[model samples]
Target chain A: MSERGLLIVLSGPSGVGKGTVRKAIFDSEENDFQYSISMTTRKMREGEVEGVDYYFRTKEEFEAMIEAGEMLEYAQYVGNYYGTPLSYVNQTLDKGKDVFLEIEVQGAEQVKEQVPDGVFIFLTPPDLAELKSRIVGRGTDDHEVIEERMRVAREEIEMMALYDYAVVNDEVPLAVKRIKEIIASEHFRVDRVIGNYIKMLKEM
Target chain B: MSERGLLIVLSGPSGVGKGTVRKAIFDSEENDFQYSISMTTRKMREGEVEGVDYYFRTKEEFEAMIEAGEMLEYAQYVGNYYGTPLSYVNQTLDKGKDVFLEIEVQGAEQVKEQVPDGVFIFLTPPDLAELKSRIVGRGTDDHEVIEERMRVAREEIEMMALYDYAVVNDEVPLAVKRIKEIIASEHFRVDRVIGNYIKMLKEM
Candidate 1:
């Protein structure tokens, strides 16, 4: 059977080390997965590139795309539209490369309805204590903000049931290894094979 | 969350080399996996151990186990009783070890109903021609027997959709690699996590 690309939705609560685990996988020579570049009306922060970090767009441009149903999922945050555009993900998949969309849990829920076959993964810390420690370790936020992040994390953990796989970020290397295996094994899923192989076998 | 064991069911068409792949994994030192030793009333072949090859039993003994619901799945084949005993599989799982059951498609189906959580895998030959060649290469079966085996293989391939994953036995190493990944990735399944972690998070 011919190979097809996978749309992987990587999400987690705040301070779950999602970025670190994803970075390790992307840097490896295994699959060379493409990260979906999001579009945002928010101002680009320091060291952020126009296309590499995000497709910085005007409010009018973002609104037109939303009106045309071009965005896969979008939301208004702090008076700016932040959303994932579908074209880039489609183009990468057409070329037979997997796309990793690192989104929040709510955004991931939206993408699931649109791409039901996408592999949704939830990253998790080892425990609530570890999650709290990670947030405190960031060393920027004060006690009240850290407490708020902890509360939000507890709520997000409840939504882990919606994901297809839940990889614990206990160790970065181990978590990345498991994610790679998940991608490799998912390629041989029976649903995909039934769709393509039943006809091929009949011809045989 | 605490770790639990996995029940892995491996099956394939006659010439797809299921034995070779399962042997590779069982012999590996990475994970201590237990092979579910089957019970058979058939006479032991040369070089076959009572427990290793099978828990050789008399017809009365096998039937007694079946009556007691001790046999996971049993069938009378060629005037002999053959079946998997549930005690061995459950004991291995209780000790936190993965259990591998290599059986035919129908046996796998029976086991699926009994233990619905098994990771059922169908190992496929690269193509029908390759499968025919493998059967002939063994040089034991005559032309008529080989032809009948091929017919059975076709029927078995049609049932592959009932499996959770299908790995093409194009090459032994590649197929074994895929199966290993399947085992590793299954540990992170969200359904298993949801069963345990939901309560753990609630406690926090």
Candidate 2:
């Protein structure tokens, strides 16, 4: 097997339950991947450990890292920097540990540009009608806000073209199951493992 | 999901336990695919029902079918003809049922030429040393014969480059599991299922 581990990015349109599915995967007994921790310039909570919960850094440090192009993807939220550290991801993969990242569609796009071989999975709603019901059932947004969210959701879904697999999140367990199978199957892909076999043959 | 079912071709070098692993897959409770029954010109043995064990055909009829390019792949063995019928396989796939074909490496190569989209899985031994021991452990062939067989096995192993996935048949159960995962994953491949999602997006 190649010592380099797979970088699996799980993302989808908003409200597709990407977080729920990701949590389920991590909680499963068979989980063997390292969850990607984000670096943030925001103040860490009392119980949050630096590096464990988040890689807490000074605003200046975050900005410096950004300037150095160390972050795989970053975004400003409430005036705080938040992003994935590309160095950590690469180090984990170099150690042959698979890394799992759950991000928004835009973040995923950014990651794809940097890591072309990453396994990108797009979690999807069962249908547009189901998505609308879920959004309405939230009982939080007003009609206009809900409509705007829907419009953005449709646009994100259109970005499915950029993903490697679109798994329907009709049920969290089923989606997790499919994701796991995809991960396992990817290990045996001819392009990934054939080099070792060819080398072995030559040695023989 | 597309109504067209997957055509899974499981093959490897001789004595790689392709038959055992394939049988295990079918024997499992989750087996849902149609086993591809081969057409043969040899006379049916007692209790071997037509179309169940094999599709019995007269030599003339088989030759005509071969002449018409109806056979997916065929070979002459012990003065009898044996091959998979392309029409039956296509009809089964058109009915939205997966077809599993356990065949030799050469036959699998021919199938690939016909069904480029077929899921071609190469079952491999854990290592060449282990393969040699397995052949020696058989204790049925002379040294020259064993050498010749090993040479053929090496050639077939080289053909791994032509496959979609190469699974090590270290154990029948483990190999079967990997094969199942490969089949399940192939269904969600971006190239295969993206069209449906794209169509749904257009309709929405």
Candidate 3:
């Protein structure tokens, strides 16, 4: 039997640049893991590909998937549904292909509940002040909205205790390098690689 | 207080090239961890440095250290005592410098009991056949001795389950790369890095 692939979940506060880091990781030449396309009811932003960035779906279609238990993890954000599709993740992993998921903290929590063995990474800004600046610089949220995001970001940083690794997203390249190292090192973890050795011992 | 450094223990069966991999790691430009010097009762061989290779000592001095609990982990092999000095390890780690210990599996087991938090790595040959060949290539043992060594090596591989990571020493450079990645990734583990975040929360 083939070894099972890792389920890598990258998550953090709303404005921690999870999407940007995920893009950098995918764009890197060393990337061997497959990206798990999330299905969302949110409008496609400029230059966002239909299936690459997200599997854009209508609210009705998304709700049907949720009803049919097709969604791996889902959450409502800013009046839109966002989630990973279940079958693709399962199938890819079963085929020994690592699946990468960049999702919100709430969705990550749900994924943790369902698949506790996944490598859950919390991408945090260098500090609270930096996190606030990133949120404000987005230019999308108003003053009150930005303040609320900072408050929520603070809470999310506290939730980092639940993650396996907390990577400071101080620089995109450095964060990418650290994430790659985490994935490479995790593959050698004894629990994940012991089965083959056990079988070898039995054969001996 | 500074963050305590990691105690990285690298071990495997005899002739698995543990020393070679450890040397390559130290020689690398990225190596920031401190090598923990071991005190041993063995006679210094040709070209081996007194304080660099090991702190060679009389059998009496080695026994005295063991009696005083100054040795982190010690074992008698080939009628000689080899062990890590507890004080140096503690002092270096307290100063936030990582301490690396490359020792036999027997000594590694002792360290596990005392420093369960240490990152225990098991370096293995690509396969049992490769392991046998490596031992045979050493040319120090006869056929019967080689067979006995293989038996012991098999048992050691069974002990891989106790280690945190199992790295295949298929190539020296590859093994070195994997070990470096393990150390880098370990630093980011939530349990190790969470204190700062928790402090930040308290301050906020």
**Candidate whose TM-score is highest:** 2
Model 1: runs farther than 4 Å from truth? A44-49, A128-154, A201-204, B45-48, B128-154, B201-204
Judged by DockQ relative to the true structure, which candidate is superior, 2 or 3?
3
Task: State how far residue B33 of model 2 sits from its true place (Å).
Answer: 1.0
Tens digits of per-residue lDDT for model 1, A1-204 = 455678999998878888888888888777668899889999989999999989999999999999998998888888998999998888888787889988877889899999999999999777643553455667898889877866766676677878999888888988889999999899888886665654544443
Which regions of candidate 3 deviate over 4 angstroms? A42-50, A128-154, A200-204, B44-49, B128-154, B200-204
lDDT of each: 0.82, 0.85, 0.86
TM-score of chain A of each: 0.81, 0.85, 0.80
- The per-prediction tally of clashing pairs is 0, 0, 0
Clashing pairs in 3: none
Report the interface RMSD that candidate 1 achieves against the true structure, in angstroms: 4.1
DockQ of candidate 1 is: 0.47
True contacts kept of each: 0.64, 0.55, 0.71
Tell me how candidate 1 scores on lDDT. Answer: 0.82
User: Compared with the true structure, what per-residue lDDT tens digits does model 3 show for residues A1-204?
Assistant: 247999999999888899999999999978889999888899999999998879999999999999998898999988999899999999999889899999888899999999999999999877653553466667887889866866876686678877999898989999999999999999999898777555544543
